[model samples]
Target: MEETRSQVDWLTRAVEALPDEMTFDAMQQLILSMVFLRQVSDVPEGEAQGRPTWEELVGQVAGKPDLVHQPVQRALRAWSGSYGKFRIDLDNEAVLGQMRSDSRVVDRALRDLIALLDRAGRAGAKGDLYDQCLARFSEDRVGGDYYTPRDVVRTMVGLMAPAPGDEVYDPACGSAGLLTEAARYVETHGGRPADRTGPVLRLFGQDINARTRSIAAMNLILHGLEDTLPRDIGTDNSLLHGSDAGEKYSVVLANPPFSMRMPLTDAGFVFWRYGPPPKSKADLAWVQHVLGALKADGRAAILLPNGAAFRGGAERRIRAGLLYDDVVAAVIQLPSGLFSHTRVPACLWVFSKSKRAHAATRVLFINAQDTGVQVSRGRRTLTGADAERIASTFNSWSKHDAADVPGWCRTVALEEVEAADFDLQPARYVAPVAAETAPGEDERRVRELTEELYEHFAEASRLEHELRDVLGT
Candidate 1:
């Protein structure tokens, strides 16, 4: 955690060092791209026979800054395949040409950042280091779109409980954080963390933006222990009106873009597993897309906007089909500000093709809107203990007939669900704590009820007389 904070602080210093035209996104791409090359290459950056590696070349520029253009250009050409579509200002910077005739500013910034990374590396903070960079990089940016706070990712990953040889995927994997955590899950479960040639783990991801995809690839190359598996992060939209790929996985964990509106490019897409979603609001569409992509007996935990829970019309129909199919396993109401991108409430919908442990006729409802500790004005995050508490509740409930905690969680039968129009709002089923009655409270309640009933009877007589006059009786 301190490493991440330090990285964020240094990233701010790096951004302040650059020209106004440079964006945090652009700066991040350049730095991480270099970091990726340094990590993936077998040879450390060095002064090798006439062709020094990029890091060695950067070091050579400290004093004689005017001569950096040629070596840096060579490095870009050498590693172009690895960095693909970075949209970086320099492909690499030519000191004299684009550095406004002063190369030291760029040189000093890169030197300092890389130095910090080297120290962190020896300090054992090398795993997924750029997650910190990306999180901090988005802080001042207009929208904190790709920042899926790490704790949320960790909790979601814990809930999925992926095992060795289990195929894991994320449809809208920003920076591939979910995939990174899933890889960790495999390692923790007595499986290899990474296998370059014959990996026991399979990682798949798709993001609509090519730039983010490239960034994700670079991020994965460095930290995820990805040297073992063939990475399959793609640039195409996974919800492409049809099968994104005929691929399915053992586990599907995703927090897809919510309330997205794109034209239905595949009108005959045949999303009948759940049902086709409206074009204007694609929340259920992504949900259906994920559901359809799951193999029989597969399990998934999806993050969704609260509207997907109880919205009327087409969404209502979708909810009915999910419940009827018995694939809707649990609904967890997350706290507000869990996401820094939008203040809209969030929830988790866990689906299982075959629920062998819990009864299919009933689903778990956990109202955790009060779970997180506020960290900022409009943001909050679940600490390790906080997440464990929430996760333990669901885990115990799923694996055994765990006693329900009043006012927090409840198991609602399908009949009750149907009575509520299949509404998934957690509060609808999980009642709040009822205050205990004081002494003599029962007599007070009876007296209040008798007086109220008599007043209602008198009003009924007056209404009857008014109706008779209106009917000319």
Candidate 2:
């Protein structure tokens, strides 16, 4: 999918043919319908488990066009927080309502989409189909947080290094990129990425938005994660209404909203594993959530705003608590413009429930803010080299043979962090660099140096004359 231009694929073209303003909800549901149809087509007839097959729907369409929505409606059984049981409203003229008016055009579009799916097969190998579906959503209908840059996601996944039989989760899984990367990690470690059944691997997610929740679930489906389709993901507020309360996971990766000042009403909520955050920002609240959700040995990588580290009062308490418990593993400051919507830069905070065995005495701090290249006019991203460098630095420190680089990375002892009042900011821990001057600063410096030398010579001559007078020469 060439994202630089509108794709000519049948999915994009068919979606473009939808009627009216083409809302976000409608587009997500429509894509879900297509994905469901594809999944149904792939399963064996006897093993469909009461799901409808795409060929069956096509057969009904061939017989009577008036009953276009009937077959799909019947095939779609309502599940909790899913497309309503008994039927999905596919014929309300909002999305497919124009099907009644321009039946021929709509039929042609649907058939073209089906033909395209058949030619390419139903399930994508890895992130292929999910990426295409996201590309389609990128046209005009996605409403949520900025998508995590692919390289950043890759780097985070590498740092966590999820293993086989690990249970991976992302709480604010806007696009499910973190879990997708986790799935990839499982495959790299001699496991299956598409294995949805238990014991091998498990992927979990929770989102506040209903539409984005649906999109996340469908994204997993397209990525060939069929067993993870109807797992623990739900459309509920992770801060207020939490999920997976007592179930700790093996790996957790997340990019929660930075400034969603969670209301302070939940001082008694069960989600407050590290107590409650301030009434202003939810940054540390998300941190506490991740920390609490981790199994005793689980490791997590979180992308958070810079404020969460050094903010005073309530945030300071959270930081101090984490440091005291020795769960704060490492912090990596990222480059600016990683997210286009906001100007605030972000950093990666890695936490391990049991760090005493590995990085027991010190917390690794990496300053990678200057390593990214400006790929676009305003967006700065980490190149493959940059990612490798950062990830390597983390691994080196984790293994206790870290090579310290000035202005790049530094390891500080836990006692030092406690002395600094638990300031987890990378700038506080990393070494400083000498001030760098601009192009013309050297010329001005040279001139100033010459003038100072002439003045010193004059003063020396005056001193010589005074000495001659004293000697009566």
What lDDT would each prediction earn against the true structure?
0.70, 0.69
Clashing pairs in 1: 195-228, 196-228
* lDDT measured at residue 361 in model 2 versus the true structure, 0 to 100: 64
The residue-level lDDT of candidate 2 at 106 comes to: 56
lDDT of 2: 0.69
lDDT tens string, model 2, 146-209? 3576778888988987766777888898878778778777787788865546456777787877
Candidate 1 lDDT tens digits, 1-473: 43446545655665565555555556666666655544443255352334456456547655555454455556655655533323222255533234444566555555565555454444343554566667766656646555577878878888777776677878888878788888877777767765544547777777877767766676666654454334456566777743346677888888887788955586556665666677788888888878877889788888889998988988899999888988888898888877756768988888888775566678989888777787765578888876677677777777775777888888888999999998998988887676788999999869866976686699689989999999999
